[model samples]
Target: MIRDATAFLNRSLAVISGIEVSGLALVFGVLAIFFVLLWLRASGRARLAQRALQTAEADAARLDTVLKVQAEMSGRMQTMAEIIGSRQADLTRALSDRLDGLTTRVGQSILSTTRETKASLSVLAERLAVIDRAQGEIRSLTGEVVKLKDVLANKQTRGAFGEARMQAIIADALPSSVYAFQATLSNGRRPDCLIRMPNGAPGLVVDAKFPLESFTALQQAADGETQAAAATRLRRDMDVHIKAIAEKYLIPGETQDTAFLFVPSETVFAALHEDFDDVVQKAYRLGVVIVSPSLLNLSIQVVQAVLKDARLRASAGRIQAEVRLFGEDLERLDARVTALKGHFAQASRDVDQISVSSDKLQRRGERIAGIEIGEEAGPSEGLKSVAGE
Candidate 1:
């Protein structure tokens, strides 16, 4: 019984040892499988892990793979989120810049519109004010025109104005000519204006006969009939005025070769040009030239050569008069200057003589002072002391 027990015990012990070895082999096999799965995961071979693994006691392996996949997805999601966030930040910054630019432009437009509106309103108000003032002035001007008509009709008043205006126009145009108003010609009819031309001859006679009534009538004529009558009357009146200017002023053989009929009003000149060009042609043929003040300036230039000589003759007479007076004054001044030079020479000689006398007096005073010193010191005794020393 003891031997049987010992054998059974050895057998049991061996069986237990085999079971423990089998359990250890199984544990080592599971550990080796886990190490392979762990290595595959570490090496980033998830596909190989999937092919090798299943729903066994490999929870950590499967968990490791799931965690790794989750971590990768999280990293990819984080990168995408970072990209989206950066785009959103960039878009926000761009939008903010565009909004800032649009706001500045809108503000500038508003300011410009405000300034323009103010300027336009100010201009409109100023125009309305001007219109109001002008309307008042126009009413006043109409009243003055009636009074002016009476004054203009007076002979002395009209004649004085005509003469004064003609004088000014001639003086402005011709600087060299000797222009005179109401000058008595050789015929003894005092022409309105006389220009002393070159060679001491009368250059041209100017007469100021303004046909204001006829010109005004032509300006105010309503229909063709009135306009034609006014125009005919104006022409006939102008022809009479022209003939009068010629008879009174123009002396064909005596006074001047060509005569000037000065019409001061540009309105008359325009009328003559428009309705009466034929009259202008006829006047020119008759050696009676019509001159506007502006044209008369140029006309004066044309005869300037004649006027220059006349002016030179007058200037020569004036220069001779001045020379005579200047010569007398120069003779008087020359005598005075010569006497003054002599006085200065004599004074210089007297001063030299006084300087010589003063030098002699200084020498004499020095001699006298030396003699007094000698007398106080005993002269011979001093001399002996000097010799002994």
Candidate 2:
């Protein structure tokens, strides 16, 4: 626009030179208006450039501040990473230690449980062994009981059993010289045993044969009527046994006034006493005593004591004679000791007299030595003077 305005001004000057002075003022006025327009446009462009420089400087300052903030944030993040790593290492070490402690405790618990289980098994085994031994003992006892039942079932074996038991007791209690088994008496009858009495007394008899059939029936009877009948028979049997023993064994000059009826079983003896008082009284009245094994043992002990006392009394006269001889010898020894004391006293007096004579002789010798050889008396004269004094 400026160049088009300048071209238009040049054309106007040429046109004016040809026309006259009246159009010169109008050309000058148009040139002056064009210069004013050019100055205004230039001033506006200068102001725009100054505003752009100020905006560029503000943007650079903001970018520098952002870079400084990013550097400080990076340093803080590195320090936090180092702290997290150290904490993780510590936590791992603590977890390992806890695992080791738990393992040790579990091992110890397992060992203790194993030892307790073994001890319980050992005790159970010992108890089973003891039970087996008890079973064996029960079996052996059952066999023995069966054998005893067989022995008691027969009549002859039962009577022999009683006789054998009585003989064993007598042999154990008395000496061989004082008793005899199955000895014959003067009446042509043999009793089971005979015991010799001391001091020339008659012998005593013991009879072991008893009426067991009636007693056995009494034991087996179940009803009242049967029991009564069995009891009557038992009493009658006891009376016959008592009379027979008295008549056969009690001879006036050969045996004692009383005899013993030996009952082998203590159970039978106890039953007889409990249920048959009349039978026991009748036997006692007829000079017969009913005795159990224990009672017979006690009677034998008494007899042994009596025999020992009699033997001791028989040796008393010899003991008295020996005591008298000892007294006579003691008197003779005393008399001899008195005579020896008198002899010792006489010997002492004779020794005293001999000492006095020796002293006188010594004094006479001393006197004779005092007399000098020049003017002393003779030794014979000195000796005569000493003897006279």
Scored by CA lDDT, what does every candidate get? 0.76, 0.82
lDDT of 1: 0.76
Error of 1 at 158 (Å): 7.4
Poorly placed runs, candidate 2 (over 4 Å): 1-148, 322-389
Index of the highest-TM-score prediction: 2
Which residue pairs does candidate 2 place in steric collision? none
Model 2 — TM-score against the truth?
A: 0.48
Q: Give per-residue CA lDDT, model 1, range 155-219, as digits (tens).
A: 56655655666778778777643677777877688877877666646557888766666777777
Model 1 / residue 155 / CA error / Å: 11
The positional error of residue 159 in candidate 1, measured at the CA in angstroms, is: 8.1
